[model samples]
Target: MRIALGLSYSGSSYEGWQSQLSGNTVQDQLEKALGKFANLPIRTLCAGRTDAGVHALMQVVHFDTDLQRELPSWVRGTNAFLPRDIAVQWAREVPAQFHCRGSAISRRYAYVLLESPVRPSAETGRVGWVYRPLDGAAMREAATHLIGEHDFSSFRAAQCQAKTPVKTISRIDLSQRAGTGSSYWRFEFEANAFLHHMIRNIMGCLVAIGQGQQQPGWLAEVRDARRRDAAAPTFSPDGLYFLGPVYEDLYGLPTRTAAYDWLP
Candidate 1:
């Protein structure tokens, strides 16, 4: 039987999602717990891999097991052996055709940034920090150029293994919310797929435009350049969150978790 899992994790203590020889990655830990729970070797394939220090609000992964266990047992049993920062949220019996990665139609990510002069202390590793005020309108204008199908070479990482730089960014939305202490900004992205460090790289450019260092048109110029040097430095991954993949309705997976509603 094939099972699909919905999970959320805090990447603060992990070495990203993929299992590594170091045995510190989210995948390695998850697989270990799952193997112990199932009393058999189990391998999982995820919808997407997140970088170090990046959280996931909803991560979908699939694995096959001959051992029969109730959906609730999969969630509770696996989580019992998992770490505090990583967890299995829900489990479902998926059809054999279901693939956590290939079945995904699109992926979404969100970055939560704290625009404050005082650097983050208690929220360290949980939120991205910016000392200066940002021009939201300018950032939005710069973001417009990034939408649609295009070669995102400038924003992709050097180590990215993607075959092509071309990707379709369907939507890029920026919303700001004021607070009693510090203001927050949420940058949401929906795309067919994202290259390694793509969003973080784009965040660097958007931040530059918001800080009035670059014109809104600069993003378009960088996109045309198709060179890594044309873009801003890759931003911090602390605030980045994998909102997870969007699968077809046939899957019937929950679109979000409670963590989604708690974000600013």
Candidate 2:
């Protein structure tokens, strides 16, 4: 039987989402825990791979099991065996043909910015700290140009191993959250797919525009340029969150104009 499992993990200790040769990985830990439960070799295919230090609020993964274990027990059992940082939130029987990664119609990633002179206590895992005053309005304007299908080579990481650089950024919603001292900003983006480090790279360019280092109109020209050098530096991964994967069948998922938030 095939099962779809909802997982959430803190990527602090792991090398990345994939298994590694020399370091701890989220996949390695998951496989070991699942193998223990199955008493047989087990593996999972995740909806997405987050880099080290990244966090996923809701990541879907699927695995096949010949042992017809109860679906609810898989969630309870997996959580019991897994570390606190890695958890199995929910599990259900899925069609054998339902693939967690390939079947995903869209992916959403949110990058947070804590624009403040002083560090914020409430935003350790949630927001990236920036000491400089960021122009929130400018950032919003700059991000508008990125909301379309384009060859995103200008913002892709040089180390990115994807076969192609083209991606359709369906939406890029930039806004500020209400706060007292530190201004909290969010960049919520939805795309059919994303290349490695794509969201952070776009955040970097947006930051540059906010800081007046780059002009707002440069984003469109950079897309047209299709050169990696055309974009600014990559933003820190600490402020980014893989909010959730958008399956076509889930109606609760936010649409283009919906206010984005962390999802389970």
Candidate 3:
């Protein structure tokens, strides 16, 4: 049987989503838990792989298994061996043709940022910080240049293995809320697919523009340059969250988790 699972994790404790020799990645821990639960090794394919210190609201993974078990049992059992930061939120049996990564229609990610003179203390690893106040209008204008299909090579990471740098960004939504002494900003991105560190690279430029380091039109110039050096430095992975993938209605998978609302 083919089974799919929805997972959420705080990536601060792991290297990233993919398995590594150190066995310190989220994938390694998850597979170990799964292996312990099933009494056999089970491999999983995820919709997307995040970097170290990145978080996930809902990460979808699928694996083939011969053992028959109730969907709820899979969740409870697998989670029983998983770490406190990683969890299987839900599970379902999927058709053999359903692929966690290939079948995804679009992927979503969100970056939560805290803007204040004082760095984030309580939420240090949970959010990205900017000491200067950000200009919301300038940032929004700069973000408009990123919407629609375009070559995102300027924002693509050097280590990215994506076949093509051209990707379609369906939406870029920016919202802010006032906190006690500072303000919180949430940047949501929806794209057909993302190159490694794409969003973080773009965030660097956006933050630079919002802080008056660059003009809004500079973003257009950077996009047109199609060179990684033309963009700003890659931002922190702490605030980055893999919001999961958008799949067809036939799959019957949950897109959002309760943590989605808790962000920002």
Candidate 4:
């Protein structure tokens, strides 16, 4: 039988989503816990892979197993062996044709940023920090240039293994809320797929425009350059969160968890 699970984790303590020889990644921890629960080794494929220090409000994965068990057992049992920062939120038996990654229509992500003269303390690892006040309108204008299908090589990482540099960005929404003595900015993105470090690289550019270092139209120049060095440096991964993938309704999989309500 094929089983799918919705997962959420604080990725600060993990190496990333993929399993590694160090066995310190979220995938390694999850598979280890799953192996313990099933009394046999279990392998999983994820909808998307998050880098270290990032977080996931909803991450989807699927695995095959011959052992028959109730859905709740899979959730409660697997989580029993998982660490406190990581969890199995929900589970469902899926069709053999359902692939966690390939079946995804689009993926969503959010980057939480804190703007303040003082560095973050309580929310240190949960938000990106900028000491200078940002020009929201400038960033919004800069973001508009990225709103369609285009070559995103300028924002992609050098080590990215994506077959193509072109990706369709369906949406980019920016919102802000006042915090104690500071303001919190949230940038949400939905795309068919993302290249490695794509969002972080974009964040760096947006921040440059917001800080008056570049005009909004500069973004188009960077995009046209199609060179990674033409864009701003990659921003911190601390603020990045994988909001999960958009799947067809036929799959009957949950796209979110309670953790979504907690994000800024």
Candidate 5:
């Protein structure tokens, strides 16, 4: 039988999601807990892989098992052995054909930023920081140039393993709000798929435009360059969050997390 589970984690203390020789990844911690709970080895494939210091509101995974445990037990039991920063949110039985990654139609991500005269403190590792105020209008204008299908090589990482540089971004929403003495910025991105560090790289450009360091039209020039050197450096992963992937209704998985309402 195939089992699917929804998970969430704070990636600050780890080296990204994929299992590595360091044995300090979220996947390693999760598999250990799942194995211990079932008293058998378990392996899981994730919907998407996140980077170091990145976070996930909901990450989906699937594994094959014959333990016959109830769905609630899979959730509560596996979580019992997971670290405080990692957790299993929900679990369900699915058709053997279901896949956590290949079945997804698109993915969503968000970057929460803190813009203030003084640097962010308590929010240091949780949100990206910018000392200058960001211009939402300018950033929106720049984002428009990236709305449809195009080569995003300028924003991809040097080590990106994606087969193609072309990607389709369905939406880019930027919002701002005033806090006690600081301003918060939320940048949301939805795409058919993302290359390594794509969001962070684009964040760097949008932020530059927001701070008036570059004009909104500059985004088009960068997009047309098809070279990584043409764009700003990759932005911080501190504020990035994997909002999870969208799957067909046949999967019957929950789309949103409780944290959704609290976000911008």
Candidate 6:
């Protein structure tokens, strides 16, 4: 049977979500823990692959396992074997055809920026920090120009492997908040899917706007440019988080409670 697992992790200690040969990865630890808990080989296919130093609040992964374990036990047992950095909040039996990645209708990402003059504290490794004061209102205005479908090549990573540069951005919002006594900014985006480093690149452009390097109308021009070099530099990965995937229909869980609840 197919099983779905909700995951959350701190990206500070690993090389990204995908299992790699060069260094430790979140997928490596997860597969290992699931293997130990199930007493058999198990492989997971995730909703999306996050880059190195990027966090995920509600990443989803599916695996086929024949073990007859209770749903709650699967959650607890798998988490027991996993390290402190990664947690499995819930698990549920899923239909064989329900794929974690392919079935996702949309994905939401949140990028954080510590934009005050003061540097962020040590506790902010996974969050982004900028040394200059940012204009949040200007950033928000710039973000509005990016909404809707467009060829986002200007904001795409040069090394992106996706064959197409076109993508539909459902929404983009830039908001400010009072951080742990400092000013901060949050950049949020929802899309059908994303290209490699897309969020980071968007964040970079927005930061440039906040810093007065780019005008609010520049985003529209970048979208029309359809060239990677036309945009600002790719921002740091520290601020990126894979918030969660949105499914249009129920994924065949036993109960609504069984749906991924790791999101906050």
Tens digit per residue, CA lDDT, model 4, 1-264: 999999999999999999999999999999999999999999999999999999999999999999999999999999999999999999999999999999999999999999999999999899999999999999999999999999999999999999999999999999999877789999999999999999999999999999999999999999999999999999999999999999999998887899999899
lDDT measured at residue 93 in model 5 versus the true structure, 0 to 100: 94
- How does model 3 fare in lDDT? 0.95
- Candidate 2 vs candidate 5: which has greater lDDT? 5
Give all candidates' CA lDDT scores: 0.94, 0.79, 0.95, 0.96, 0.94, 0.83
Better of 1 and 5 by TM-score: 1
**Candidate 4 runs further than 4 Å off:** none
Compose the digit string of candidate 6's lDDT tens values, residues 31-126.
999989988989999998998899888788999877898999988999999989889877878888898888888898888787666766774776
Candidate 4 differs from the real structure by a C-alpha RMSD in angstroms, to one decimal, of: 0.7
Counted clashes in each candidate structure:
0, 0, 0, 0, 0, 0
Candidate 2: Cα lDDT at 148: 81
Greater lDDT among 1 and 4 belongs to 4
Q: Please give the distance, in angstroms, between residue 108's alpha carbon in candidate 3 and its true position after superposition.
A: 0.3
The TM-score that candidate 2 achieves is 0.91
Model 1 segments beyond 4 Å from truth? none
lDDT of 5 by residue, 171-230 (tens): 999888888778999999999999999999999999999999999999999999999999
Is candidate 4 or 5 superior in TM-score? 4
* Candidate 2 weakest ten by summed lDDT: 251-260
| Candidate 4 steric clashes | 0
Local error of candidate 6 at residue 71 (angstroms)? 0.7
Candidate that scores best on lDDT:
4
> Candidate 1, TM-score vs. the true structure?
0.98
lDDT, candidate 6, residue 217? 94
